[model samples]
Target chain A: MEITINQTPFKLPQGASIAEAIEIFGAEPPYAIALNLTFVHRQRYGETFLTQGDALEIVQPVAGG
Target chain B: MSLPENPDPLVLYGTSFPSRLLLGTAQYPSPEVLRQAVEVSGPSFLTVSLRRQAAGHNETGGQAFWDLLSTLKIPFLPNTAGCHTPEEVWTTAQMAREVFETPWIKLELIGDDYTLQPDTLEMVGVAERLLKDGFKVLPYCTEDLVLCRRLVDIGCEAIMPWAAPIGTGRGALNPYALRLLRERLTVPMLIDAGIGRPSHACEVMEWGFDGVLLNTAVAKAADPIRLAGAFKKAIEAGREAFLGGAMTQRETAAASTPILGTPFWHQNPS
Candidate 1:
């Protein structure tokens, strides 16, 4: 299956969970996930499944005024 | 001589802070400068934002930035900077809460791209939802009386209105409206943007505003550390002045010296 993380396309095995996608995308700590614009709690990362063409946003803290 | 430290602290959402200034973590020359500035300024809160993970640049400077923030130990007020609609604000705010581990969110719903003015019409609705979601929302809005009133009516404990457009440093473009908002709303009001100098922060603080949030002025200065200290003192002075109460304006001149005690009065023509 194919999914977009931070708008970058990635190929993962079918039935891949969000945790697997995080592993492939190389996410760092102090980050949060939103699956298709909905926040996904950290506890549910393993159970959440992604479909083809799903948009996943991995957002991290940055400097802002 | 400096006035005694204000015993009255700036309270927001039932939390009291010794300092009224809220500093931003962005645009400092370097992390070291940011650290020094934060230390010197001693702001009550530090504003931050969340951005999409930069693709391929995993070694990006985010780690160091986060590290610095963690070390500061100040409370974080994560903002929804670039969101245009309520949904975007919602998602961004949710992510911010999880990442920052704070319920405080600076709600910024931009209605225009050029001015970066918040969508006042949309802000009330967004704020209502965030408040219901258990987020302590600090909405960034324009200096409009009705808009501010609506926000307060909708359960916002504090409101952050721009002094001018973001990054403009123009400083309180509409003093009349801002003053009216201050007079009308009992909630804490903070001048969030368009503050260019320490005097700008002082002016708004003198208006009885609860606090000021600024970045570009200090961060872009030749010496961010010095400017940060300056802002800190200015805020304290202004708060003290406000608490001390100011004299009313007068058109006629009033002499400070005692008229009867003037030695040269006899020499003046009668």
Candidate 2:
């Protein structure tokens, strides 16, 4: 199945967990992810499952004013 | 003669800040420069944001930036930089709270791309949602009176109105409106963005604004560190001036010397 992470396409196994998607997406520690425009807590990453074309956003800290 | 330091500390969401200047962790040439600028400015609070991680790229400078921010020890404010809608802002704010573990958020809801102006209509709604979720919201808005009043009405304890558009560096675009806000709103008001120089920050402080937040002026300067120190001192000076009670301006000239101590060149000679 194909899932979109940060607008990038990635092929992952069906019923892939959010944690596994993070691993395949190369998101490092100290980052946050949103599945389908809603926040996914770190503790629930294991339970959150992703399907094809799921929009997952992995974001990190950056400069702001 | 220098006066005694002002004892008033800026209290936002129950936290007290000794320094009234808030630095932005953006536009610096490097992470080291941003760190040094924060060091000299002595700002108690700073602003940061969250960005989507680039594809197949983890070295997008997030870790190093976080590392530097950690060492600086300044409380970083997470903002919804490009979020156009309340839902976008809400989602981003939630993620930021988890990532930084801070309930404080600088909510930036842009309505127009050209001006990057904040969405006044939706600002209150966004703030209300965040406040309900126990997040301390400091909304970045224009120098509009009724909008600010509504934000206050919606239970925002602190509000940040732009001095000008973000990154314009024009400084205090509307003094009258800003003054009115300072007069009407009892809650903490921070002049954020469009500060071009130290004097700009000082002027806002002198006007009794609780604090000033800036990024481009200091970060884009030739000597960011020195400018940061200058801003720090200016804000302090302005705060002192406000506490000292500025004298009202006069239309006619007035003599500082008493007539009893007049010299030979006094009115008698004339």
Candidate 3:
């Protein structure tokens, strides 16, 4: 499946859950995930399935003052 | 003079803030925890900064944070903290408007690298441009009465005077100047930066500041959520006290007793 994550497209295995995509991208655990403008809860990521053209955004907090 | 059943509403640039506490979205242990702390703080205004990711580096995933903020349905006050020039600040403000779809910006133009102080000249310049562009400019500046007046003259909607250097945690260093600014400035005045604790925020409110903007003080606390709530309560109490008008103090004897000592049974006849 072709998915756009943070404006960049990437190929993922068919019927892949968000959890698998995170691991596939080697994303860190402490990051937050948003799929299609909605935040997917951490506990629900393993069950939340993704499809083609899904917009995924993974955000990590940075030091700011 | 009494505390209202609900918090008083503070309106800035057309948005109404029930709680005078403005929170920063930074330095939390995690985004989840930051959201929790923001909830605990009960802030109507949240501050976020704009910065470019490294060159050609595209994937920041910053949308998740924005998603949460949208869900919260609170007014987001995007800040120009890192910008040092008027052009940079103006550009960042435009980007923020593009991304957040809001014209409200916390304009911060740092002058020196060491202290991270605001450049009064650049701040005035950018503020004039932003105001003319219809952006609500909340300039983060020093406690200079003249500079503040200049910003107001240039059409800034609000003035956010720093208590001290950014993230210094030194708390309010110039209470007198802050008090004067609060009294003098016609628009809303928020004491931003160098607030280390809830008490500091309370003190600023008690000194008649219109609002408080703090990030590191709550986000870096041992218990971020709890401390956020603490600050919320403290600011409320302080504002209440300020409106209630605290009793005056006396340096010398101006008491019930006269200068001459009264006899033991002097009041018996009365």
Candidate 4:
């Protein structure tokens, strides 16, 4: 199956969790995940599944004004 | 009408802030420098951004920086920096709320690329929607009094008008317009961007603005830490001047010392 993560497509086995997608994407922790424009908490990441064409945003802290 | 007996806090969304200065975490030489700057300057609030967590390139200081901010224990106000659409602003605001655990958001919808001006037409809609969704929307908007008045009518208690475009450091480019805003707008106003010096911050604060927000001016300075201290002092001075009932300007020169008390006396029949 394929789901878009941060606008990038990735291949994974059936029923891939959001945590799996994060690991495969090679991103570290201390970031937040937004599934379909709604926030998915860090504790629930392992169980949060990504459907085909779903948009997931991995947001990290940055400097802003 | 009743008079305010004492100085009041910088109140927004029913919350009070101890300091009138707001700093940004961007463009610092290093996170450590930013930390020291925050410590020395002592702002009650600081602005932060959320970016796509990338691979091997924590361009905006990703996780480590987040941890550093946590240690600082200062409330970080998140911004929708690069979002062009209202939906983008909503998504970014939601993500920021979850990440920072705060409902406060600085809404930025870039309408133009060159001037970095905000989409004035869209700002009101975005602010209304965000407020409906239970987020404290502090919009970065222009000095257009009509548009700002509408925003205030839409239940927005606070609005930030740029002194100049973002990162330009030009200071208040249109003092007339901004001064007009100060005179008419009753809601709390924060001069959010284009402040290049401590004096700029002071001048705006002197105009009865509740606060001033800036980034590049301090972050890109030769001595960011010292510059931070300078801004802190200047903001205080400006706030005090405003509170003390600054004297009215005059077209003709007026002497402070009385003429009657002058030794070289006024009334003489020579």
List the candidates' TM-scores in order: 0.95, 0.95, 0.73, 0.91
Model 3 docking grade: incorrect
Count of clashes in candidate 3: 0
- Weakest ten-residue segment in model 3 chain B by summed lDDT: B52-61
Worst 10 residues of 1 chain B by lDDT: B55-64
For model 4, state the Cα shift of residue B253 in Å.
1.8
lDDT of each: 0.91, 0.89, 0.79, 0.89
**Candidate 1 on B125-147: residue-level lDDT in tens?**
98999999999999999998899
Candidate 2 lDDT score at position B201: 91
- Name the regions of candidate 3 deviating beyond 4 angstroms: A1-65, B1-7, B54-61, B252-270
RMSD of each: 2.7, 3.0, 9.8, 4.0
Regions of candidate 2 where Cα sits further than 4 Å from its true position? B1-6, B55-60, B265-270
**Interface RMSD against the true structure, candidate 3:** 9.2
Task: Give per-residue CA lDDT, model 2, range B1-270, as digits (tens).
Answer: 985664788999898887899998888887778878988988968898999877443332477777777899888788899999899999999999998999999999999999999999999998999999999999999989999999999989999999988888898989999999899999999998889989999999999998999899999999999999999999999989998999999999998978675667554844
DockQ of each: 0.75, 0.80, 0.07, 0.69
Between 2 and 4, whose TM-score is larger? 2
Candidate closest to the true structure, highest DockQ:
2
Pick the winner on DockQ between candidates 1 and 4.
1
Better of 1 and 4 by TM-score: 1
List, residue by residue over A1-65, the lDDT tens digit for candidate 3: 99977667879999999999887776653355667755566778899999999988665433234
